[model samples]
Target: MPVYKDKNGTWYVMTRCDDWQGQRKQKCKRGFKTKREAQDWECRFLLQQGGDLDMLFKDFYKLYEQDMKARLKQNTWEHKACVIKSKILPYFGEKSMKDIQARDVLTWQNELLRHRDKHGKPYSETYLKNLHNQLSCIFNHAVRYYDLSTNPTAKAGSIGVKNAKEMNFWTKDEYMQFSEVMMDKPISFYAFEMLYWCGIRLGELLALTTADFDFKNRKLRINKSYQRLKGQDVITEPKTKKSNRTIEMPDFLCEEMQEYFSMLYDQKPDERIFPISKSYLHHEMDRGVKATGLKRIRIHDLRHSHVSLLIELSFSAVAIADRVGHESIEITYRYAHLFPSKQAEMANRLGELKKGGGF
Candidate 1:
């Protein structure tokens, strides 16, 4: 039994109890003027208390952590935890699981829209899309187990449906200009070369140990990557099954890598091929680009340039996909420009196959 106040003054109400476990003894402070209002309010409040949204979220995460440990690979859990901490937790960590609304998610998305990276570039549409995707997964799990109102992220919708237009790749002369500027910084310069020629990721490149290179076979093994998990750097397995493939190094680059290896301070087979921090490598890359007067060229674009060159050299899509560790041909299709120009050139030769009429 509880006393409550209203415009007419105070009135008494008593909650019905069945058992100790089912009974809700909490009192409402505000007085409901009508008997129906009071009954509805009590019922809703009791339902909410029974739900215990805070406890539900905490318990859900505990189950998720356990399932992740048992079902997911170490690298997968590490990656999810990293993103959850760095990109997600700081925003929605304390939010009530059931009360979090669509607007709350939209506000967070808007904030991420204006967010910038360490390099001062605004968050890419691609990056935001990925963040939203991860958030959606988390919400989906919550909804499945915790009885949330709904997944707030599901209502946020996509930022955009279309991807940005393709970027301009470098010409042969442009690549030469880039190389000339980077001559003084051999490690950064050659690291770029390796990524371009080998078509492996920067993470994969850094994770390479000396023993992974097969000089006699002219092959480079790529099985691991340096990933940032929970703000700490760690060597982890690649993202997909295809990422474990070995690639043949170009003759010239192979020779250069051999020379680079010989110049290493530690000649141990287990030592990292490039023994520099990511920052130092990126700094050198930026410096070289600046010195070359090509500020628009990104390190990633070097990979694009390499794929473009391979297309010009007439490699098939399957071959290109294999080299680049693309899980599907759909991904390879995004880089299709490499082959089209060559195809057009080859098509021009079709005119030569026709016989010419005599005058």
Candidate 2:
């Protein structure tokens, strides 16, 4: 490596490389402000010849984003970029990829663990795990493609857990109480009905249009999901292939929606059934919960409440999974853990089976 300075007070670096025809070539890059900048450029130039691992983490992350951004949905990529820019980059942006060790990763994890927000709140365990996974993923990419020794995160181990908290949901009676409170507003009532009865995601529910409902057959077709991203409303494919499904509507719900539709003046079939923002739905929930004095739950908990209702009705995992568009029956079975009160009921049924000489 050779760095030189001229009377003009600028620094430059030169390097030798082999040309295509087996000829020696001298490449010079100039106009860096400081000798450190010149040496840094020279170091990167030599390391480009050595391996990709010596590049700064930020530079490698750009490569990572280039390779990955096109493969993900816009909203998904936005979330990853936000996390990387906000949480991961500040600690390791300028560090060389190959120089980050398990201890360095551990140090970063401790700092994140102790981090507090403006409201004096720490990141959720799941969020901590998400950040760690993002950092670990970068290293994993290097190991798989750049011939790095190992993923330091694999050695450091992962923080947080997959299911950080138990499911929060309402029973049929509890939901009925809340639903009664929402009945004063027809839109709120019908929206909660769909969420509790169909077990669809908020995006899927918001994406529903008048044309999607077949009142004659009491069925609802779900194909697209709605997202409010970057200050625009976006309609994208459902969360999974299985999420593109048809749900059978309850007779009462079908009747209720029919009445609700009748109230709309000159609404088109293509228009959203509920042209309301998520904030509106949330506010309605707060109002309903406050009016009914019921246990407070998130809008998503309505979906869980639906699944639990199915479990209580003795529905099979496969049936529940199909109804909810779960990717696998195993996912539906995860809700089984939420219903521990069923243990005594199971024992009682087994006792009856023993008395009847049945296994």
- Which candidate number would show the highest lDDT if scored against the true structure? 2
Show model 2 residue runs off by greater than 4 Å: 1-51, 118-120, 339-359
Report residue 144 deviation for candidate 1 (angstroms).
3.7
Winning model by TM-score: 2
As a whole number from 0 to 100, the lDDT of residue 130 in candidate 1 is 71
Clashes of 2: 0
Tens-digit lDDT track for model 1 on 1-359?
A: 44355567644355643334775454534655666666655654444445446543434455557645767766677667777778877877666567678898899888888877789988766667777877887778767765666888888786632345355567667777877777777787778778767767878888888889888899888888876555676787886788889899878988988878777785777667776666776787677667777756656666777777887787777887788777548446676544556567666666555444322
Each model's C-alpha lDDT?
A: 0.70, 0.87
